[model samples]
Target: MSTKRKHEVPDQQEPKRKHVEEPDQQGFTRKNAEVPDLQELKKKQTEVPGQQEPVREKVLDHIYGNKFWGPYLSERQWCTVREETLGNCWDSTSYEKITHDSYRWGEDGIFGLSDEQQKLCMGLTLWNGKDSVVKERFFGLTGPQGNLGEDVKELYFYLDNDPDHRYMKALYLYPQTEFPYTDLIEQNKEGFCHSAGKGVFDDGHWQIIVEYTKPESDTILCRYTVTNISTGVQTLNLSPKFWFRHDHDAKHMTDVSCFQVKGDESVVSVSYQLEPDCCYATYKLEVKPGGEDIIEWELLPVGKPSYIDNSSDVIQEWKIKAETFYNSLYDCQWSDQEKAVAKGAWAGLLWNKQFYYYDVDELYHRGQAVENKVKTVKPGNWDVMERNIKWRKHFKAKDILSVPDKWEFPWFAAWDTCFQMIPFCRLDPDFAKHQLLLLLSERYMSPEGQLPGCEFNFDDNNPPIHAWTSLKVFQMTGETDLNFLFNSYCKLQKNYNWWMTNLQCSDKYIFYGGFLGLDNISVVDRGCPPEGYSIKQADATAWMALFALSMVQIGIELTRHNFPSPGDIQKDLIKYLKDFLCISHQLNKDIDNGGMWNLEMTFYNDVLVDQLTEQYIPIQVRSLVGLLPLVACGIVNFSGIRCTEELKQALQTDSIHVCDITCGTVNFSGIGCTEELKQAFQTDSIHVCGVIKVRSLVGLLPLVACGTVNFSGIGCTEELKQAFQTDSIHVCGVIKVRLLVALLPLVACSTVNFSGIGGTE
Candidate 1:
C-alpha cells in the first residue's frame, strides 16, 4: 500500500496508479477517448442528425450564462507555465540531477546577478507583502483523472507569503446585467481579424481585454488591457510569473546559459543570446490604475535592441494597419456577423502561417521513401535518381512561408498552397503574389521544371492549379504589373511542358497520382499505377485542359501589353487552345462511344481504359471525376481568340457540346434525371449530388465548376429555380460546417447574388 494524501504535493516514492476508465458526464471514457482527428470530427457533424449547430448560438448562450460561465471569465483556455524535468531514471544522469541542473538557491537567482548577466535572462513572479511568512505549495492538474498527468510539473506563484493560491484573477463584472457582459470583437479593424474579448473584471470594475495578433514579422503578440473602473483610490499588487523551459531545443542548452533578467520600477525585461549572431528579448509591463502597458517580446538576429525603446511605436503601427483593414471591410456591404466570420477566417490563416526550415538531406531521404513506395508497383519508372541528385547538390535548409495548420500539416502542398492564396490575396495581394512566384523559383522548382508536390514527397503530382489561382487573383485585383504576368507565364509554361512530357498517357489524356488531394474517391487506386497499363484520369486531363486555357489567357495578356515574346506567345497560346479543344472533343466522343454514359441513368462516370485490350470500362462511382469536364470548360470572347476562323468555330461548337454533357449528366435530383429531366422536379426528391452520402472535396467540385455553365441559356424550368432556392437554404444551414463548401452556393448562381442569404460580397 502506498501512503499518499489527496491534493498533497507528490513525492518521487508515490506509487502511480493506472489511469481510470470512468466515463464522464458526456459518456466519453477518460482512458479510452482519443482526441478526434479532423476527418472523424467532420464525420460526426454530418452523420449525426442534430450534431450540426451554429457555434454563434453556443457562444451567445455562454454569454447569457444559461449553460456555463462565458469563456471570457474563465481561464480554462489560457496557457500556463509549468516546471518540467527532461530525463527519466533510465537516462545516464539521475532524475534528481536533471531537476537541479537549472535550479538556483536564494537571492543569487533573484537580485544578485550582474547587469551584463541580467541582460540574458528574464523571469516573472508573484510577490506578497514583505512581512508575511513564505509558504510553498504546488497547484496544478495532477491526477489520473485530472487534465494534466502526475509526471507533468507546473510553475507556482507567490503573493506576499501565500504560494498556494490562484494569483491570477480575471472575471467579467457588469453591474447592469445579471450575468457578466462579454463581446467577441475585432481588436484591430485594419489587421487581419485579430479577435479580442472585451469585458469588465473585479468589483472595482477594471476593464479587461485580451487580444492576439500575428504580424508578418516572426513574433506573436499577446496584449492585455486593464483599466480602473472605481472612483475611489485603491492599492493592488499583481505579478504574473514566467519560466523559460530548457527542453524546447536541447541543442541550445549552452545558449540558454547566456539568459539573464533585469527589472526597473516600471518594467521587467529578460534577454537571451540565442546564437553568436542572434538574441531574444521579453519585457513585462508594470502598470498602475488608469494606465495601460504592453509587453513586447520578440526573437531576432543579433542587433541593437531598438524594439525595446520602440515597442509603443510597433504596437501603434499594427493598430494603424488593423484600422485600414477594418475600413476596407466596412466599405463592403457585409453584415457584422459575415464580416466577423471573414475576419476570423483571415485571422486563422495569418495565425497558422509559420517560417519553417527543412534539412535537404532529410527531405531527400523522405523523397526516396516515397519513390520506393511507387517503385513497388511500377519499378524503374518511378525511381527518383534525378530528384535525389538535384536535392543533394543544390538543396540547403532555408526558411520558407508555411501556410498550413502547423500542428496537423507542417509542410506546404503544391495545390493546397493555391487555395491558401485565395484567402491571402484578399488580405495581402503582395504576399499572395509572392507565394505563387516562390513555388516556381529556381530554388524550389527542379531543373526538370517540376514543382515539388510537397516537402516530403517530390515525385508525387498535385493538380496544375497555380495558373488558375494567378488568373483569379489578377482579375480580382485588376493588377496590371507586367513583371508578375510575364514571370508567371514563363514559369507556368515550363510546368505545363513538364506535365505533358511526364504525365500524358495519350495525346489528349493525362495521368495523375492520389496527390490530387481527393483521397479514396476513385475506383482504381490512383496512387498505384496499374501493373502493365497506363491509367487515364478524367480529373487529371480536365486539370491540364484548364491549365492550358490559363496559359492562353496569359499569352493574350502579354500580347495586349506588347511584351517582346507576344508573337511566339500568341502562336503557342493558339496551339494550347487547340489541344484543349481536341481533348474536350475526345472525352465527349469517348463517352458517346465507350458505353461509359448511361443515357437511361443520365450519369457520366470515369472510364478505366485497358491498354492491352484497347477497351474501356466505366467506373460506376458518382464522384467529382464526372464533373471535371465542367471545370475544364471555359468561354473566351471573340476578340480573345487568335486562332483561325475554322478552328475558332470548331472550339465554340465543342465548348457548347461539353457544357450540355456536364449539365445533363450531373444529377442534382436524387431520381437520376430520368423523370426529373422531362417533368417538373419533385421539390422534396431533388437532392444536391453527394450532399449527404459522401461529403468530400469531390462532392463540392460540382459547385466549384458551376461558373463554367451558362445557366441563363439553359432554359431553367420552374422546378429548377425552386430546386436552386431549396438547395441554397440547405447549404446555408451547414455553411459553418465546411469552409470550402460555404462559398459554393454563391459561386453557383451567377445572375442573382445571394447577398440577402449570407453570401459574400
Candidate 2:
C-alpha cells in the first residue's frame, strides 16, 4: 500500500464512484461523482479532441481567461467626466478634437471590442470615399449644442449577446454619401432645426453586421458582413483598427500594450502581446474578401487550437449554444414574439457594459508623472475645480461597470446602476453581485458611507436604492452567498445612518432635497427650492421608507440563517422596523398637519415649507412622485421571523398596530371628480392654483398597497367584490377610503392624459 492517500496520487487508476450532491465554486448545487482519483482528474484537465468545458463552469471559476475579450469597449468616451480636462466638459472636448486627441481614461469606436481591462482595443472603421474623415467613433451632440441635452443621432441596435460574451452581434447602417456631421452641428447650434441625416432606403447605404464568437476560452472569432442595400453597385472602404490606450509616461510603466502583425496580404495575422510573463493572443484575418463578400478573423492564444473547424461552422455551433443558454433563463411560458423582445432587451443590457476607469486620488494629488497635464482649460477656474473635487480625495474607481447609456452617460449613476442590476442578475448573478458590492466597497463608498452618486459630482443626491437592490439581487440568486448579505447589510446600515443624519428634516420623518432621480418634472427644480423654503418631497420620504423596509428584511434574513450575531440583528431589526413605522405615520398623517397626503384631493404632493413663516404650501403637481409610495409596501410575516418580546413591543409602539381586513360600500361623497378637474381636462387649460381634486393614480395607491390588487391577502372573487362593491377597504392599519371611479376607467382605456393636468407650452 502507498504511504500517501490513494486519492492524492497524480496518476493512479481508480474504480467507478457513486454520485453525490456538492456545492460548486459559486455555491450552485450540482450532482457529481465523488472526487476523482488524481490520475482521472489530470486526464480530464488535459486537452482532448471534441471535448470542451461548459460555459457555466467557466463563469463559476471566476477566472479572467474566458472574460478577457468582450464588448467592454465604450460607445462614447469623449466629453466624459474623466476627459473633462477643462473646467467645462461640454466645451472642452468635441467630436473633431477627440478624433485627433488621446484619451487618458478609455477608448471607443464603432463595433468596438476590448479585453476585460481595456489595455488594447480592436474596432471597425468605414469611409464612403467622399467624406473629409473616416467614420470611426459615434457622433453625438454635446450637452449645450442640442435642443435637448445630449443625444446620439445615428440609428443602431445591439442584436444579440450572451452573458459571457461567447457570442455577440450588432448592426449599423452606413450611408454611401457623406455623413451629415457638419449639418447637424451647424443646424443645432443656430436653432432647433434638424435633419434625420441621409435615409438608408433613398441614399445608397451599406447594412453592416458585426459578430463575435469564441471557439475556446482563450480564442475569439469575429466576422463582418457588409451588404449593399442600394440598387447600384457601391464602393465602401472598411478597415479594422487596433491600438493601445494612449499613455504618457513610459519610465515607470511596467506592463506595455504591444501589437505585432504577421502573414501575407491575402491572409493577414496579428498578435496582441499582453503583460509580461502572461498569455499572448494571435488572430488570423482574411484580408481578401471571401466568396460571400464577408471578412472573417480568428483570435487564438499561444497554445495550438484543438480544432480546425471552419469559421461558419464554429459560428453556427456557438449560436446554438447561445440560444440554449438564453432558453434556460426563462422560468415561465412566453410567446415567440415575447421571447424575441426579451432577448433584445437583455442584449442591450449586456452590450452596454463598459470598462470605467476614474481615479480621484490621481486627479486630486496630481502626483503621477502621467497626471501632470490635468488642468483647467479655462484661465481662472483651477481654484474652483480644486474646491469642488477636494472632498473626494478618497474616491477611486477602475472596474467593468454597467453604464446606463454608453454613448450618453458612459459612466455609473448610483440609482441607474441599481436598476440595471435587476436584469443583469438574471444573466450573471455573480457579476451583478460584484457590481453592487463594488459601489459599497471602501474604494467607491465614502468614508461617511455615502455612495458616490455619479462621476460628475460625488455629493449629488440620488435615490436611495442600494440596499433595496442588494437584497433583491441576493433573493434572485436563491439566497446563496450570505457573506454578500452580511457585508452589504453592515455597509447599508452606515448608509442609512448617513441619510438620516444628512437628508432628514430636523428629526422629522420627512426627507428633503434630491431630484429623486426625476428631473424637470417638478414645478421648480426640487433639488434647489426657493431660497427661504425647503421642499419636503413625497418621493424622497417614500424612498427612505423602502430603504428601511429592505434593511429590516435583510436583518431578518441574517438572523434566520444564524449569520454571525443574532443578538445584534435583533437590535438592528427593532430600529429598522421603528424607522419604517415612523415614515409611514408621517406619510399617512392628514395634509393639514404637515403630512404629504392631501385629504381633499386624496393624493401625495411636495409641500414647500417657508423656513421662517412655517407655512406649508403644497405644490400640487400630478406626477409619478405622488404614486411612488406604493413601491414602499412589503408584507411582514411574523411567523417566519423570530419575534421576541422586544419585537412585539416595537410593533405596539405609536402609529404601529395590526388591523383586521374590512370591506364596505364604495365611498364617493368627498372623493368624486370635482369641477376643477373637469376644467383642467375638458378645457385642456392647467392652473397650479385652487384645490385640485383630480382622481389620479395617487388616489388609488393606498387601496392597492394593502394586498388588495396584485398582492396575496385578497382572493380573486373577494377582491372583485371589494373593488366593485366596497366604498372603502382597510387592511394592515392603512387607509383606503378614496374611490378609484374616474381614474381607473380612464387609465384602463389609456385616455388619462397627464399633459392636461399640467399644461405644457
Candidate 3:
C-alpha cells in the first residue's frame, strides 16, 4: 500500500498512472527499475531539438511560404547560349557586359538568392579598391582561353544548407590586390600553370562569409562577414543588390517600382503592386585587426523591420537552430570531423541548383539569321550551324534545375540529371520527383518522344536512364506517390518507343545512335563514323535492356497497388517483361555477326560493321563499356499477382544466362594467378585483359548480376529452376572475390554453399 501526498491525486481519479516496478521478496528493489514520470517521457519522445518536424510537415503540405525563397540563383549567367542572339555563346557575351547589359533570359551574382519563378532577385557585390570593376559575378576563362576548357578562377566554399531553404551559408574569398583577370586567361592558354608565376590564391585575399536566414516565412535575413587578411588596413565597398529581371514581364513594372534609400543610407525599399513590397535594412559593426566586421541585411515587408533593432539576436538564434538541426542527423559515435565532411558535401549539392531558362525556337530563328550573316561574310563557313539547327522547334526550358556546375555546364544535361536526383531524394523527395518529371514533360520532350540531351545539342542520345531513376526514387521514398509512378510509366513508354524506332539499325536488335554522351571514350568518333559504316553500341543496347526491366517494375507496381484505371494494366505489364527477355537475348546472341560479346577477348565490345562488305570487327578495349551489361541484371518477384497463363509462361524464361557468361570471366580477372579456374574450365587463350584484374570496381559488377529470384506464385517451371541454378553459381563465385569476403562477414554471416560451387572455408 502507498500513501498519496497532498499534491498527488487518487489513482482512480487520474486518467493515466505512472509506471513503477514491483519490489522483490528480499526487501530490495528490482534490478533496472525506477518510477518513470509520464510527462517527462512524453516530452522526450515528442520534442525534437531543432523542431524541424514542423518545417518538414510544412514541406509535405506544400506550404508555399516555407519554400518561397532559396539558393536558386546562378553563379555565372554570362557566356551561356540563352543570352546570345548571334554567333557562338562564348564570343557574344563577356564578364564586362554582365553589369551594364540586361540579360534576356535570367540573372546571376555572387552567392545570390531568388524566388521560385526568379522574378525578384537579390545578390551581393564587392569592390576591393584595386580592381577596375566591381566584383559582381565570378570571373572565369572562356572555352577558347583555357587549355582545360572553361573553368571558374575564384575560390568559394559551400558551408551549410537545409532542405527547406530556411538557413544557408557559404564562403567566398576575394583578393585584396588587383585581380589577375587577363593573366589568368593568357596563362591558361599557354599551359596548365600560370605564366605570370602566380597562383590565384598565392596572394593575400579577403575572406567573405555569406549566410541567409529566414526567421519567418516572409522574412529573409542576410549576413556578410568581411575579414581583412592583408597586413595593413584595406578599404572595401560591399553592396547587397536587389532588382527585377529585365524581361518582357518586368519591363512594365520598372516605372512603378523604383529603389528608395532612406534612414541615412541604411535602408533600401521597393514598392510594387504585383509582388510583395519589400525593404532591405543594413546594420554594420566596427572593424578591428584580426577581428570580424559584419554587415547584415534584412528583407521583409516594407513596414516589418522589427528585427532590425536586434538583428544580432535573430542571427544567433537561427544559427543555433541550424546547428541543432544538423546535430540531430548524426549518431553519437560519429566524429565531429566526419559529420562536417558529410554536411559540406550535401551543402554543395543544394547550392548547385540554378534557374535555367532557354527557348529553343528563339535560338533557332536567331541562329538562322546569324547563319545567313556568316554565309554572306565567309561562304560555306556556317554550314555546320545551319545543318544542326534544323530539328529544334520543340525544345523550350524555363524552370529551376539542378546543374553539374553553375559556372560550367550551366544547363541541365539529361544523364547528369539522373545522377543528381539520387542524392536529392534523400534531401527532398518532392523536388526529386518534380525534376524527373520535368524532363519527360511535353515542354522539354519532343512530340516524337525524344528528350533533349542538353541545351547545346538536342538530338544527341543520352543513355536512357530516366526510367531507372524514376524507379529508384520510388523505392527510396518507400513507394509512396502513386501519381508520380503512373505518370512516369506512361511518359517513359513513349520514350522507349522512340528508342526502338530510331536507334535499332539491324533486325538483330542492335542499337547505334549519335553520341550516347560518352565523348572521346572510343578510338574513333562514334557519333560520326567514316561515312559508310555503323558501330553497334554495347552500352546503348545494355541501357535499353535496363530500361525495359525498369518499365516492367513500374508496371508491376501499378498493377499491384490497385490503381483505378479502365485499361488492361496486366497486358501491358506482360509486354514489358517480354521486351526485357528479347533485348537480353539479343545482347548475348552471337559475337561473329553483330552481337556485343567478344569470345576471344572474354568481354563485351562495340561491333564495328562494314555496310557494303558485311564485315563485323570487335574493337577490343576493356573499358566501362564492357562492364555496363552487368547493370542490366535484376530479379522480378511475381508472387501476389493475378495473371493469365500467358503472363505466367513469359516470366519462366532463362533470365540468368547472361549472368553465367559474365561470371565465367571472373577467373581471368585475378590478381596473379589461380589454379581453381584453370583446372575447372577450358579456354583457348590465357591473355590478360586488364592489368588491375579483379581489384578495381569491375570485379564487383558480376555480383550485381546475381539477384536472388523467388517465383512463389508461378509454379517451379524448368526454365525457372535453370535460372535459379545459374544465379546460385554466379552468386557463389562472386562471393569468393577477396574484397567481398572481407566485407560480407561484417554485414551478414551468410555462407555460399551452393551445389555447384564449393564451400568458402
Each model's Cα RMSD? 21.9, 16.3, 19.3
Q: What is the lDDT of residue 471 in candidate 1?
A: 78
Tell me the tens digit of each residue's lDDT in model 1 across 605-634: 555667788666666665776556557544
TM-score of each predicted structure versus truth: 0.50, 0.73, 0.72
User: What's the residue-level lDDT of 731 in candidate 3?
Assistant: 31
Candidate number with greatest TM-score: 2
Point out the higher-scoring one by lDDT: 1 or 2.
Answer: 2
Please, what is the whole-model Cα lDDT of each candidate in the order they appear?
Answer: 0.41, 0.65, 0.64
Steric clashes per prediction? 16, 6, 0
Q: Residue 298, candidate 1: how far off, in angstroms?
A: 7.3
Candidate 2: tens digits of C-alpha lDDT, residues 1-761: 00011112123232222121112221112122121112343355465544444533443244446677788889888887776655677765888877545566778988787777775577888877777887888887888878777878777888889988999999987776778887877778777644345353376667788888878765667777776766665666666565556542222433333322322445423322222111112212112222113655554432235333477788888889988988987757888888889999999999999998888755543323332322212121333454237446677787899999889889998889999999999999988989998988888888888888777777777889998899899999999789998998998888999999989875299897566666446688887889998888888888898898888878877877788777778888888877876777776665568788776666778888889988888888777887776667553433344445665445333323211110111111222334543343332222223222333445457755343233345544656556545445534323344454212112110011122112212
Candidate number with greatest lDDT: 2
Task: Name every residue pair that clashes in candidate 2.
Answer: 664-726, 665-726, 665-727, 666-726, 666-727, 667-727
lDDT (Cα) of model 2: 0.65
